[model samples]
Target: MRTVHEVSGLAGVSIRTLQYYDKIGLLRPAGYTDAGYRLYDDTDLERLQQILLFRELEFPLKEIRKIMESPDYDRDRALEQQIALLTLKKEHLENLIELARGIKETGGNTMDFSAFDTSRMEEYAAQAKASWGDTAAYKEFKEKAKDRTSEEERDLGAQMMRIFAEFGRIKDTDPASGEAQALAGKLQAFITEHYYKCTEDILSGLGRMYAAGGDFTENIDGAGGKGTAGFADKAIQIYCSRRGAAANCSMEE
Candidate 1:
């Protein structure tokens, strides 16, 4: 038998967190010593291991409880699935490293820049989930990323691409101008219509991303030539300010 402190130390979890878990009925001591101290046996240790594994995958506590009680639950099968996911992640990372090396060996960042592909960025994100210590938190973040249907994503992608293509032709355009603002309005509505129900917070965050990141910036800029994405960001900031909670993007009430 081991005390809660001993088990928590061994499991690399905080005592307070363990207490919360116990309060939630996620993992409670199976027995108590004569001194009224909590004690864990082998069964409790195994249960804790399962809980940790699920936590590592970023499964919500509600989801984890349901999964644990599922009739299809198989420990060996779950472990096998995790191992396979790890292997894929390793292979993907290796490929990324190879690609980076090739790009460096070739030349600098020109029109032929090798690292511009967007899908590579997506794959890198998937690999990062495994690379980071907490798979669960990453999973949670990813789940909230976007939940539009495949058809909706394709439609938005097509529409945005066309819009950018048109905008790209006008070099010195004022994004805050009425025409640009209208375009931004359409884009925001497109996001609301298709993407995960958006909020001002999410809309604002994405606007910042389009302006700042290499991935989003490049895609937005692809329309106008060099600075189109930045224009879109400015326009969006204004649009979101006007839209706010009415945008229906916020999960918050």
Candidate 2:
């Protein structure tokens, strides 16, 4: 059994956060100690790990609670999806790093924009469907994403690269600055408009994926500096968190 402080310290979250999760029934204690203190056993710890993993994925607390409580929820399947998404995010980040380094070696920006590798989208989609069955949200989001041609997606990619370049020009910029935060808001709107519905939980999760995961962290850092991604992620999080959604989403992926 572990005390709240010990568990929270290990999880890199505050004790208060755990208490709040408990309060919301997102993660309940396994038992109580002699002094009536919460005691977390192995089962609780396991659930906590899953909750933390989803939290890192930017799931609102409520969404995570629903997911955890759902009888059909498959932990391994969801974890695999999170791992794959994080891996893709990491690879993209690495590609940006390579591009930046290449520009440094060369005299100017070599405009070779083949950074995205999309040959596996079909296979991945098939696998996801096989694993998760047919989810309305997943199907809807993917279909929306499919409406764009590969070339259009590339243009969007280029537009984002341009944004990163601007961030590089102002690494020490304040996240709350009109320029930076405004751009952040623009990015949020863009995502919300095109890809998926921008619920409070979805927005927060996507924003956190920009930092909590290593691939996201590396991508944001490689684009500008260590600061830009952190700032953007925080700004987005704050914006989404204030909307009062508690991450109660049930999207397949």
Candidate 3:
């Protein structure tokens, strides 16, 4: 058994936070001492670790409590699920890096959607235009893309998709590394080339959109393999941050 202070120091959480967790029954103590001090056991510490992990993932307190208290709760299985989700997020970021690279090399003129359904390109374009049509950048994107032939669009889209796939393979790299940042820069350039100027304002909005679920997220995730959208969103935010632009890096959807 250990005191609240010991648990706090070990978990790196504040004494107040632990106290509150106990008060709220989010993490009750294993027992109390004769002196009225709170104490926790190994099981309590393990449960605390799970709570912290869920917190990192931004799960609401209530949601985390419910999940942890569920009769079906299995710590090992939960950890596996967490790992899979995090891995998907990492892959998503890597895909954005690759997509950005393609944009830099080809000036945002390629699209490789082999991993995606080819029939969905038109649908995606329509949805994109509808989503951002009111923006000046969307207008510019339409004008620039208007003259491209169907075959040209297909080829370009395919190439871009291939880049996203490459990112998924390299998702384990540091997001702030030269390679990651370079990919980020490429992504910004790609957006500026194909869509709009991609200013910090635009980039921030796009980042949120990528993280937000829907067709765009689906497109990137599908092409890049399950987590590309979130990954791209993070890379874009990092890229914008490096440029001293306002960036929202929250993973909350």
Candidate 4:
């Protein structure tokens, strides 16, 4: 076991930060010494390493806690994501260095700004965050899914896909039409019932994800047919905007 001071030296984390982590229930030492000093064992150190990795990825502490405390948290998966994100960061830095050298060689006349483009890194980080499920909705989802078997889970997923198939049937219609909007409402309610509380904000985010051209898009399209994911995203955006406006009106009243 290592004392708090020893951990601070070894991990390069300050004693105060470790104490704060303990206070916030983010990390608890393995035990306490007779003199009330914090004592951390190997397992505790391992958790701390995970926490530090998330921190280096710029995750908020609360989100990190939610992710690490999640029932579905997988250490190997987290490590893989961390390595991917870090590699992206490294490549980004290298690009900036190359751009700097170019500028220095050209007497600062280089007009190219491609190195400043961080869209790829940011997109990957967002995807990583979503995969980590570092939100209240994910926590609720974990609670709701904890007792389900694999077959049951598959059934639920298939049911959800049927909703997308409905979206596919209406892909040719205007997104703001009553039919599309109603379908969007149905999708929101279904998610709320089976997954988590699909608030307007969360639903809007999901809409974007559906059309983001990755697994979500592929799976949604596979369920609903071609262009279905984009159609659903459009409908969801309209639904969420109208709902948000109504909510604001109610608040004002």
RMSD of each: 14.0, 17.2, 18.3, 7.2
- lDDT at residue 39 of model 1 (Cα atoms): 88
Q: Rank the candidate models, highest lDDT first.
A: 4, 3, 2, 1
Query: Highest lDDT, which number?
Result: 4
Model 1: lDDT equals 0.64
On residues 1-253, what C-alpha lDDT tens digit does candidate 2 reach at each position? 9988788888788888888988888888888789988888898888888888767655567767766776657888677656755565566668878888888999666887766553233233333333343455455667887779999888876777567656556657665566765666677666656665555555555555565444556666777777666676666666665445334243322
What would the per-residue lDDT of candidate 1 be over residues 1-253, giving only the tens digit for each residue?
A: 8998999899998888778877888888989889977788999899888888767645578766665665546677455444433443455567667777776887744334343444433332333223233444334544644575778667768887777666565536776678877777666666665444455555555565565444556776876689876677677677777666455566564
Per-residue CA lDDT of model 3 for 1-253, tens digit only, reads 9999999899999999999999889999999999999999999998899899778655678877777776546677567445544444455566667777887999878686433322222322233323323556657877888899989888877766766666555556666667666666776777787656877656655665555555556777888777776776677677777676333334332
Q: On a 0 to 100 scale, what is the lDDT of residue 151 in model 4? A: 99
- Superior candidate under lDDT, 1 versus 3: 3
Model 2 gets an lDDT of 0.66
lDDT of 4 by residue, 1-253 (tens): 9999999999999999999999999999999999999999999999999999989988899989988998778998788667767766787799999999999999999999999987656765675688676578878988999999999999999999999999999899899999999999999999999888998877887786677555677889999899999999899999999999999999999
- Compute the lDDT of residue 40 as modeled in candidate 2: 88
lDDT of each: 0.64, 0.66, 0.68, 0.88
Residue ranges of candidate 2 with Cα displaced over 4 Å: 107-253
Rank candidates by TM-score, best first.
4, 2, 3, 1
Candidate 1 residues lying further than 4 Å off, grouped into runs, are 92-253
Clashing pairs in 1: 57-136, 58-136, 168-224, 197-249, 198-249, 198-250, 199-249, 199-250
Task: List the candidates' TM-scores in order.
Answer: 0.38, 0.44, 0.42, 0.56
